[model samples]
Target: MWRNTMNDITLPRASNHLKADALDIGLTEFIEEFGDQLLESLNRSNPPVYAGIDNPARQWVLEGLKRQPFPAQAQVVQAIAALLLDQNEQAGIINAEMGTGKTMMAIALAAVMHGAGYRRTMVIAPPHLVYKWRREILETIPDARVWVLNGPDTLVKLLKLRDQLGDTYDGRQEFFILGRVRMRMGFHWRLAFWQRRAGGGRSLAACPDCGRLLQDQEGNLITAEEFQREERRRRCDHCNAALWTLMRPGKSDGGSRRNTVLKSMCRIPTIGPVRAERLLSDFGEDFLASMLLDNVSEFINLMDAKGNFIFSDRQAKRMERAMANIEFGFGEGGYQPTEFIKRYLPDGCFDLLVVDEGHEYKNSGSAQGQAMGVLAAKARKTVLLTGTLMGGYADDLFYLLFRILTRRMIEDGYQPNARGSMAPAAISFMRDHGVLKDIYTERDGSSHKTAKGKKLSVRTVKAPGFGPKGIHRFVLPFTVFLKLKDIGGNVLPGGVH
Candidate 1:
């Protein structure tokens, strides 16, 4: 036991030993003396060249913005604007550190782009910051119009937008603040089908009001999967009988229909079970359904039965401004906003799309990423706002870049697969400009007779950080990177830590 323990704890001799004579030499001197080619491989200094922001875009931002930006912040706005304006780039990134006033800078960017003929800007922000964006936009741009597309009335506003398209350019810049959650949110839906007697204790999914099998155009019977669609027509086609129901899913269908609705509607603000029952008794289910399913703007415009102008004034600026947290579940078929915009709104309806916390869209499987990508395609140009643009892995930025720089991505042979993400292209990118490791494991000195005795395996994994080629190709040309160090000394009382 002692011999075995000593053998186990023994140390092996070095294959090559360091010589005492070389101890006095510094690392650089030693490498130069023994391996001189290492000195030749060191890269030369490459500094970032700043773009001049003396153009009209800068003037527009300066003349219009209420709170003037610091010279460095102005530079960030100017640099990003140049990519969209002078260079005509479809997308640009502002990879600035936190506490850099990205909100104020973004408003200024909108002003600059508005001056350059990009009048409509859509900002996809976090839910908590939706109102913040609205407040900043309203305060910064003198006569600008801001819409918060993050509430329960989002669909109503979208419908209103659908109605107001193609109006003559009123020269007023409008900013639409869509919450990331709202952007990817899908509405509650069930395929409208009727119940018909099939005799042997079986009921097929048929039109609720009309007896028709839900089938595809090819005559194939529609599966339950077909009901899970992005955009749905809730009414029946044969007789226009309403096929779909409009209500949030309940815990269980355990009570009478009136009680179910009363219980559900009671959860919303401004109404309790008693008020809900009164509403049900007064308006009936069908009218309420129509209001809940569509025409939410009309509901908010409702007059008090005793004659008040909550009606004259859901348009009331005072009441409206005071109601910030008021939420409702009004929307059209609860379609995902991105899919709705893609199908209904015209291309280029929004002139610019500003993605806040842009790093959130880096995942290949992110629903918001796909939604943002769809919006990017719809908008004329895009500007991504992020603190950490690259999360070490090369593929992290693949889907994001594919969304923003689509034309260039396609030009470079990065196209989407059947599911619409450039996954294969991302793999190819990882191989080309990112690090990947192929690992092999084998059991050498063991002989086994069981079926589970297999011992060799190969696996591949991505390593951290993008390569130089990737930086030069995708990041260097498109990103406006600003650290706190750039503006900290001038803006903050203490220097950047």
Candidate 2:
């Protein structure tokens, strides 16, 4: 098994044939007949192509395309906006070569999302690019707000804000820039204090028997069912203390917290109450309100409020501890989009999920891939922008493809973690298929055979070549190969191809 795990299996290459004029005619006729369908699919699916345009800002951006010398950025912005506005099924992959202005395109798309009322936009990127992203936002979106969420110090500020404000009434519409690790870590919080403070938590009642924490129906200090069975409420047969103290909703109350406001203002780095107030004033009340909601929603809902649901405080605190466990500055094992999204974003929050360097997640076993999978599952729509999509193999597309079409993975017989490994079923399926190039194999007997004893040899197709004609063509079965060289480096001293 271990040998099978690491061996490189080579595959036989097949001979190929080509028919040039027929291919040309077929291509021409196909373009003439089904060109619109092809273009539509490209627009809807591929990068550097317009998907659709509906939002007004997107329209303006698209319209701006008509005026530019090249108009690539405007066109991409319009396409991304269109994809988001349409809430279409297909995600996007922008595979523009590096140094081709992907950053500008990403920023333009972000502006379009903001204009369309997207609440929170999490950008996962390398650490060096964090400042660059901020600069791009400032340059392209003059009226837009930005926040760089970096370092433990930043978390301290956010936690302080939560401790003071209780997840409400701070205006903040700022953009948050964080390292990819920080973005994955997201947020989680304990629900115990919330239960204690919120009136909806378990109620305090007297037990006629020996005192213990008991429910209203009064059985043992266990489940509500146990409480219903007992005639007299509360009191453990062993302990004699009052049965309950009325554990409120597992939520914290910053409203009653003295110095809550002071702590909120003081926690912000390099900004005391005076500076926090001044910054708040500069941005205005609405911005601060947006910020508080965005930064600290996990701290809000547990407050004993009207119609609050009880999901078990102990479980919630355990989850919070998990969320708070930071590894290498990223939220490794604790990535939870639902909780963070609920706290910070408005209902139906993100209009689009724009994934940059989408090819990075082509390996479903990767953390980036898993994290993107979560976001893709949550977002209303998703757009993956990457230039190097196929990467010389068909299975290279399978991982990212299945992630976007989440149901497709299941439909294609890809089991979920039945093997106790992160390798997605899609990857395994691709290996079963003929997409990935086989490099090695191992055998126990003298020959490789099926269970029925049928022999088998794995094979791969060799990359074809271009013929004398400018189009891609296959090598002839009978052909001669030759190369010309300056025998003494003097035949063509200043030559060029």
Model 1: clashing residue pairs?
187-334, 192-243, 193-206, 193-207, 193-208, 194-206, 194-207, 194-208, 313-316, 392-465
Query: Which digits, one per residue and each the tens of the lDDT, describe model 1 over residues 1-497?
Result: 12243213223334466433322334455565767554344322343344463666476656657877877788888888877877888899999998887888888988888877888899999765776788778778869988878755677788889999967778999999998887898867555555544556545456666677666668765544454462666665567787676656544355455555565456555556776777787777656655543334445455656765333442444333433333334333366778879999999999999999999998888899989999999999899999999888888888889889989878878887789656688888899889999999986645567544547889999999788888888898899978777885666666333
The alpha-carbon deviation from the true structure for residue 142 of candidate 1, after best TM-score superposition, in angstroms, is 2.3
TM-score of each: 0.68, 0.45
- Lowest lDDT sum, 10 consecutive residues, model 2, at 471-480
Alpha carbon lDDT at 396, candidate 1: 86
Off by over 4 Å in 2: 1-57, 61-70, 154-173, 184-351, 407-424, 427-497
RMSD of candidate 1 to true structure, Å: 9.8
Per residue, candidate 2 scores C-alpha lDDT tens digits across 1-497 of: 12242233223333356433322234466577889998888556534323334446565643433223124455555655554465453455555554545656666666566555664555555544566677776766665566665443455444443464345533333455545555554333211111111155654433445433443334533444344444432344455543433322323245332233334434433336675565455544444444332332233223233556322566445433433332222111233433454465443344456566767787757666766676676666666666565565545655777777666456656666966553566456555542455544434454446443333467644332222321111111111111122122322445521
Cα RMSD of all models vs. native, in order, equals: 9.8, 17.8
